[model samples]
Target: MRIYVLSRQKLLLGLLFLFTVGGILAITQFTLTTPSLVRTPGTYYMANTPEKVVALTFDDGPDPIDTPDILDILKEKEVRATFFVLGKAAQSNPDLLKRLVKEGHEIGNHGFNHDYQQRHLVKEMNQTDQAVYAATGYHTYFYRPPGGFVSKTQLETTNRNGHVVALWSVDSKDWRNPGVKQIVDNVVKNVFPGSIILMHDGGYQRSQTVKSLGPIIDALRARGYRLATLSELKTLDSETK
Candidate 1:
């Protein structure tokens, strides 16, 4: 009887452990997927405005092949975007970084080497900031955590460094290489007023991203949405308030 009782207690303990783990995972998923819930004082996923303005942001870039093409498309469309470029990439492709600044695109730090560890947050950000400034002579006020995996401590460190943590409301998922149509549909269907759309210009083969760019721009414009840089979108949001 004692052995039977002990076995039952062990089963209860095992179930309790499973429940705790599941609850933690559920919270993490919610925080990652729901921009509004996760946004803290220094983070912005979407602008709180009724204006027909949206921000388009690119991450992990300044790619030698794909970035130039993406820039050309943006120029042709008369659209300005914010690029959250990695430090190493910015250092290696300084000319591309300069071109980005010269063409009036905003630059943000994506960390030095894409390190997402809490302990390395400050160093990664500072290194990226230095690289961007050295290349473009422009200071960036925005920082995007690698993979959107930000801890509270990391967010606090970022804010302490005078950077706004930028997240996205509409994710194009172009990084997945899901296909050009799927990428376009994801942006067009999900974007709303003051939405910040996430796309990638580097970190992998981004030919599809470049191809989908024109269509995404045209569709959004047709929907009466104006694409703005991250800073401009913030201004619009503030003005409406």
Candidate 2:
């Protein structure tokens, strides 16, 4: 099981190889390097820290069904997470956005659409920011580019807009509808201190994702890991620096 999960991890890392030479790209600092708590300005992957903590983050969400179910699970477990929401979804579900903030979970911008190769980067960021602000009156502090694809231009725009580019170290791959147990192992086995675990709440059926939440939270807690929102993790990164 460990080998299988490790292979999946390797594959995801390759898919997310990230970064560029000159024009701007993602740095591969998310690859579990200890004592390398280096902070790349305007961007974040896994924080370089040794605290027994990890952030639970969801992307492409604010789905009325799956998101609420995920929220219910989170609420029942008394765990707070960070949610990356689409602009259109947030516009459609203002109440959900308010609920997330009211419930103490942090919200992030996922873009106006899920165009992983979107061309209108600035527009997408603006629209999502507007939708979030309209719904909750909170400007998003974090932004995850579509499909974790960041360009130099996007980074500059995000910085100008005062948003941090967020990435993940551990991917649940729940979008593949991989079994609940596999999803659990994908996250549980890959996490290190200050790891950011990515899962999805919207964009699909996501029942497996909803189901895996309890076990993922339970396993991490049992292993003496404290789950946190990405904001908290970033704050820790700053204080330690």
Candidate 3:
């Protein structure tokens, strides 16, 4: 009887040890995959506001072909948006960047080449900032990492550059060119007050994005939601709060 009791206690202790180690390993894996959640400060997924307003932000943009179509649609609708542009793209199409500022839109840094490794983030950010400023004379205050991948060093570097890291609450997935209707549905269905909607005008085939833009704007406006740039949305966020 004594031997059986000792063996049962040993089994319970071993199981407890395994459970603890497994829990720790699981947490470490989670943090590694979702570093933005653990490392960044003021990383806005969505603004906490009750007002019927949303920020429309585009990434990997200033494309000569698709960007003009997007700007035309926004102009017709009188809706302004923020464009997170790559430095290399901006240098190639300085006029489009200037036109974005002239049309009352905002420009955010998307790094020099949208580097996936997230190396030299600060240098990339500065290069993008200088490019936009040279083209449009507008200084950017927002930086969105490519693919929304954030690291501890990237976060620190971005903050040190005096830029807020912008993330999306509603992703249109338009980059996939997943049918015009699907893209419109993604934004309209997911958008809420103070929500940031992500779309693309540059990387990949964006004809679907351009086609869906007009409808998305109309849908959001029909729902009594005002489309604003990131800077405008930030003001609304503060006011509503």
Candidate 4:
């Protein structure tokens, strides 16, 4: 019957639309932020080097309370890290930002604002890089998109600006305030050679992050991994090569 034929066509169209959306999500889930250009021109972090080196990168912070505590731990540990600080936070907490630089930690840009959803709208990649450099007086060559969200344009533009698009292999999810023990457990369990671990020092109550850092560092070192800032890790890798 004509009615039956129309029903079948409608069902087929609905199925096709669902399939198209699912397919796009599947591809974007992993490859969404990846640049189309296969080659990474200037080296940022070594992808898979065999040294007992790991990079600890903190995003979204420089919070007055948490940032100082995080810095204290890092100072005690005598280890360096990479702080992907937001520009707005940097402007507000100039001393904390300066202290991060003074203490030998490598600083990277995490944009002017911490809006996890705003990728390329407020500030283009060029503007982002300039603002960070102008505020911090350090040329930021590494970028972590806010909230781990990035579009094709953001990734391509960041790469074009000579900044590597940073993604984390280990996420503490400490923002969730998972008990400090759980956060340490998660990080220790997931870390591997060449792993870039993500944590935050700048926003909200990050007491857990500060608490977890010492144990995490001790555990990772006990497991034969040495923590390095991004630049130091890159340098160690380059020296060997």
Clashing pairs in 1: none
Tell me model 3's lDDT, rounded to 2 decimals: 0.88
What ranking of all candidate models by lDDT puts the best one first? Answer: 1, 3, 2, 4
**Model 3: ten consecutive residues of lowest lDDT:** 33-42
TM-score of each: 0.86, 0.82, 0.83, 0.77
Clash pairs for candidate 3: none
Stretches of candidate 1 above 4 Å error?
1-41, 239-241
lDDT of 4 by residue, 102-178 (tens): 89998888877766666453364455556556655777778877766666776677677677777677777787899
Candidate number with the higher lDDT (2 or 4): 2
How well does candidate 2 score on lDDT at residue 47?
A: 74
Clash counts per candidate, in order, are: 0, 3, 0, 2
lDDT of 2 by residue, 131-194 (tens): 9999898999899887777767878888888888898888888978989999999999988998
Which regions in candidate 2 have their CA more than 4 angstroms from the true location?
Answer: 1-42, 238-240
lDDT of 3 by residue, 1-241 (tens): 3554458889999999999999999999887665334434558667778899999899998899999999999999998999999999999999999899989999999999989786888889999999999998888898899888886677777888899898888889887788999999999998899998889999877999999999999999999999999888888676445
TM-score of 2: 0.82
CA-only RMSD, every prediction: 3.2, 11.4, 5.1, 4.7
* Model 2: ten consecutive residues of lowest lDDT: 30-39
